[model samples]
Structures are given as structure tokens and as C-alpha cells.
Target chain A: MGDSNVTRRSGKNQLLDLYLTFAKIGATTIGGGYAMLPVLQDEIVTKRGWATESEIMDYYAIGQCTPGIIAVNTSTFIGYRKAGILGGVLATLGFVTPSIIIITIIAFFLQNFAEYPVVQHAFNGIRACVCVLILDAVLKLGKKALTDYRCVLIFVAVLAAALFTPLSPVLFVILAGVAGVILMPRKKPEKTGDEKASDAGGKEGTS
Target chain B: MILLRLFWEFFKTGLFAVGGGLATLPFLYDMSARTGWFTTEEIADLLAVSESTPGAIGINMSTYAGVHTFGVIGGIIATLGLICPSIIVIIIISNVLKKFQDSKLVQKIFYGLRPASLGLIGAAGLGVAKIALLKTDVFQESGVLAQLFDWKCIILAVCIFFVYRKLKHSPIFYILAAAAVGIIFKL
Candidate 1:
């Protein structure tokens, strides 16, 4: 009983720490979820050693499958790992609370605010910046994902389908999964010790 | 009855929209077509507003659509419904993650998922391009030069691209800078 109690107490403390950590991530990261990657990697992997880089990448992949923001998914995964269900909730809340609060405040003033020249100009500029950020993310992810011909083929085919056809994004994702399943080399190439370490290291940088 | 239905539809949208907020666009397009909740033009406007705002694009659009459909309560309901799935999933996943942490199957599944995720992001880029680059009747019918293209957005895109390459600065800086240029040029 005493052991369980201590574990529970420690879990709660860990949850609190995760919440604070996510709050800091939320407050500092300028471009939201994708931009949060480097900072999250630093805090969760290098600084704290909460999860290895590969684990963080796994969380990111799973986050893509689930709803809400990627940042929220990541925070939930990390917090859950550290604590439990309550930790997941607290971490997600901490991550999203900043945007929610900021948006709510903006909502009050934005209707009329857009009419203002400065606000209009600012938004116009912001849109361009967002495009740049997204492009940067694409480039970064592409570098890691497109290491081989099969991956490149998937990227190009999917991009073409998305750009030309009126196919649903969900359908496209499903198709890619199907293709990956079919095309992935039969022998899962054994990773050398160095390769494994590098993979982990690459993940660590992004975690 | 209609309001409740609207809430449920948006709720489902929130539930299924994987990847990110942009993933909601295809669903929203279907919603507009099926229910006549809004028009394609309205969707464009919604996209513009959502892009400008400070929240997840999915949440922002949900709130906007809900408010348009009913009122503030509708907006709240839609937003709640969209986020509800994430809350539930996170709770469940958090509990079980450790047991599955090192599983090869999990790794394989994610390996497959990476390409799909990239595809989704790419699709989002295309969607944005369609809106930003392709000039429709609005620009075309106006005049010969207008029909050629909206050079302003194009120029802005190129200029920003170069600036991004040169400065390697955070997006906020570029956003602010582009907005300054837009206002100066009246674009």
C-alpha cells in the first residue's frame, strides 16, 4: 500500500512537471505544432531524456493518426509516458490552452480588426510567413523520409495525386499505407549498430 | 433539430480529421456540398479567416461554421466536439503506450504511416496553392492583365522565399514583413 501510494504521488508530481514543460513549449514556439519539434526534442530528449528520439518520432507518427493538434498529441504521449491518464489530460490542456486563450481574445476584436490597414497588412505578411514555415517543414521531413527510391516514389505519386486529382486526403493517406505495405523490402534490412545509433540521434534532434 | 445535426456533423468531422487542420478541408467541402451549410466561396472566405487567425485551422473553421449555423453556443459545441476525440484518445493511448513502446509491429505501422503523413501535408500544400495561385473568374473577367495572374501574391511568395533563404529567420518575422509590404503596396 505504501509503495503504491508513493508511486501515485510521484506520478502526480511528474504530471505537474510535464504540464509546466508543455506550457513552456506552447508559450515559446512561434509557428505552433511543427515548429515545436526542435524545442520538444531538446527538452524531452537531450535535456530531460524522457524518451529516445525514435520514441518521439513514433509519437509524432501516431499523433498524425489521431485528432487535434500534433503538439497536443505529442504532449499527451510524453505526459502519459511519464505519468498516466491524468498527465495526458494536463499536458494536452497546457499545450492547447495558449492558442485557445489567444484565439478567444482575438475573436473578440478580429471581426472589426481586419478592416484596419495595419491588421490587414500584418495578416497578409503572416500568411506568407506561414507558407515559408510549412515549406521548411516539408523540406526537413523530406530529407529524412526520402532517403530511398521507394520513399521518393511514394512522395512524388502522392504529391501528383493530391495536386491533380480531386481525391480525398483520407483516401490518399490510405493508398500510401497500402503502397508502403506492398512495396517495403521483404527483408527488413538489419540496421548496423552505427546506423541504429544515427537513426536514434536523428530522432533525438527532432524529438 | 437542424442545429443539433450541424453540431453532430462537425463533431464527426473533428473526430475523423487526422494529420492536422488542413485535413478538415476535404470534409468541409463535402459538408458544404451535402448540407448547403455554406458555399464554396464561403469556404474560401473561411479558409482566409482561419489562416489569418491564431488557432488550429480545423478548430477555427469549426467555430466559424458553428457560429454561422447557430450562434455562440453552436460554436462552443462544435469546438468541444472536435476536441473531444483527441481528449479521449490521448487518455487511452497514454495508459497503454508503455506496454507497446518497443513492439516491432508498432514500428512497422509507423514506418508505413510516415509516407502517408507526408502525402497529407503535401495535399494541404496543393490546396493552399489552388487558392493562392490559381486566379478564377474574379480576376480573369476584370481585365487582360488581371487574367494573366495576381502577380502581387506571386511576387510576395517569391520575395518571401528569397528572404527565407537569406535570413533563415523565424516565420513570425517574415509574416510581419510581408504584411508590411502588402499594406505599402495595397495588395
Candidate 2:
């Protein structure tokens, strides 16, 4: 109980650190979630050692299927790993602080900025690079996620739906989860007959 | 009363708009129908603003929409609503289902999810590409190949693609460079 209390006390400081770090990321990143990935890799993997690059990709995948902004969800997950529930709240709040302020300010004062030609031209250019950045994410994720034909098939089918049909991504994700359950097979324990070996393997064996 | 309605509306939006920011568009459309808070055209405008802003489009849109209907406080409440589900869901997964991470069932779910995730990302990318590369509506209206492309953005995209292949920079650098190109071309 004393140890748990000590951990919680120090966790408050780390929670603040998480808030500031995510605040910077939230303020700086543009063009949305995929654009945030490279920044996240820099902050989470290289800077903080909070997660691995592959781990970031994994969080992103889970974040996508989960509700809410993938970027904020990812921030919450990272913060939770570091400091528990309060950390998650701080991280999410930090990540969104700049956005809420910016949008609210814009909503009240600068709603007409979109009509400006300079802004229009700027957005037109920005949109293309956003696409490029997103493609970069696809490439990086492809290296990690696309290990087999089954993976490829799922990707292709989902891509077609995204481009052609206005399908809810939630529906597609649910369907994918179901597909996963049906298509993926269990890796049978090899030492099923030997109880002692099975015991050892059950404790530690992994792919 | 307005705040409660705003919170409930965005709460539902955040709970179900899976995939990411753009995924919320359909839900927002449904919202327009039910509450008459904003029109489809306004939502489109909000999307542009959300996309260009330095955060998740999902949060930005909800905040903007909230502000439109109520005020700054409404913006806060609505954003809270949208993000509440993510916090709840993620906290549950982290605290309880952490064990399931290693299980076969979880592994299988991920296997299926990875590909679908890719598809969603790819489609989002394709949507951006279409907006940047093609003049689909113009082509639809004119039915002519000659009037069917935004050649300037296309050339710029191709060049940027190659440069991005050889080098990497912060996202801001590319956004600024693209903005410069836009200004130069008076796009």
C-alpha cells in the first residue's frame, strides 16, 4: 500500500509532463491523424521511449477502430501507460487544448477567413501534401501490417469500400473484427501431450 | 438545455464515427437533419476549417459545430461529449483488457483489423488525392477530358512526392512550401 501510494504521488508529476508534451504535439501537428504519426514517433519513441515504432503503429490501428480522434485516442493510450487514468485525462485534454482554443477563436472572429483567396490557395496546396503524408503512413504501416495475402485481401476490400461507397468506418471495422474471428486460426500448442512442457510453455511461449 | 443537447449529439458522434476525423462527416449530416444546428454546406465549410487546423478534424469540427449552436461553453461541452467515449473505452481496454493483448482471440481480432485499418487509411488518402488531383465535379458537369484535371496541383503533387521520397522534413515545412506554391500559382 505504501509503494502504491508512492507511485501515485510521483505519477502526478509525470502526468504534467505528458500534458505538456501532448500539448506541443497537438499545437504543432496539422493535416490530421496521419500527419500526427511522424510527430508521434518522434515524441513517443525517440524522445520519451514510451513506445516502440511498431507499437505506435499498433496503437494507431487500434485507435482507428476505436471511437474518437485517433490522435487523441493515441495520446490517451500513451499517457495511460505512463500514469494511469488521470494521465489519460491530462494527455487528452492537453492534446485538444490548442484545437479548442483555435477553433473557438476562429468560430467567433474569423469565420470569413475561408473566403479569402490566399487561404483558399494555401489550402489547395496543403491538401496535396496531406495526401502525400498519409501515403507515407500507408507505406510505413504496410511494412508492419501487410505480412500475408489475407492481410492484403482485407486491405484491398476495405480500400475499395472507402473510395467507392460511403460506408461507415465503424461498420467496416466491426465486420473486419468478425472476419478476423472467422478467418484467423488458433496456433495450437505443440506440447499438448506433455503436461510439464505445456505448463512451461503456457507461462512463456509466444510467437 | 442547449448544452445538454450539444453534449448528447456529439457524444453519439464521437462514440460511433470510427476510423478518424473525416469519418464523422456522415454523423454530422445526420445531426443536421435531427437538430437543424447547421446545414450540410456549413458542415463542408467546417470540414475545410477542421482539416486546415492544427489538430484532429473530429475535435475541431465538434468544437466548431458546438460554438455555432451555443457559445464557447457549448464548444467545450460538445467536445467533452465527443471525447468522453474514447476516454472511457481506452481506459477500460488499458486497465482490464491488457491481459487480452496476448490472447489468441485478441490476436485474431488484430489480424483482421490491420487490413481494414489499411483500407481506411488508403481510402482517406485516395479521397485527398482526388480532391488535389482531379476535378471530378467539373468533369461531371462538362463531360470532357480536357476540363477534367487540376494540372497545377497535380504537377506539384508529383514533384513533392519525389522530393518526399528522397528527403524527410517536419509536416509544417511541407505545408508551408505547399502554401508558397499555392500563392505563387494564385490557386
Best by DockQ: 2
Clash pairs (backbone) in predicted model 2 = none
Worst 10 residues of 1 chain A by lDDT: A188-197
TM-score of chain B of each: 0.65, 0.82
lDDT of 1 by residue, B104-165 (tens): 55444545556656655555554554455446666667766557555777778877778776
Runs with alpha carbons beyond 4 Å of true place in candidate 2: A1-13, A28-35, A185-207, B1-5, B16-19, B22-41
lDDT tens digits by residue: candidate 2, B46-99: 988887778888989999999999989989999999999999888887765587
Best model number under TM-score: 2
Cα lDDT for residue B58, candidate 1: 68
Q: Which stretches of candidate 1 lie over 4 Å from their true place?
A: A1-75, A78-84, A102-118, A188-197, A200-207, B1-13, B16-48, B64-78, B91-104, B129-139, B142-156, B162-169
C-alpha RMSD by candidate, in order: 5.8, 6.0
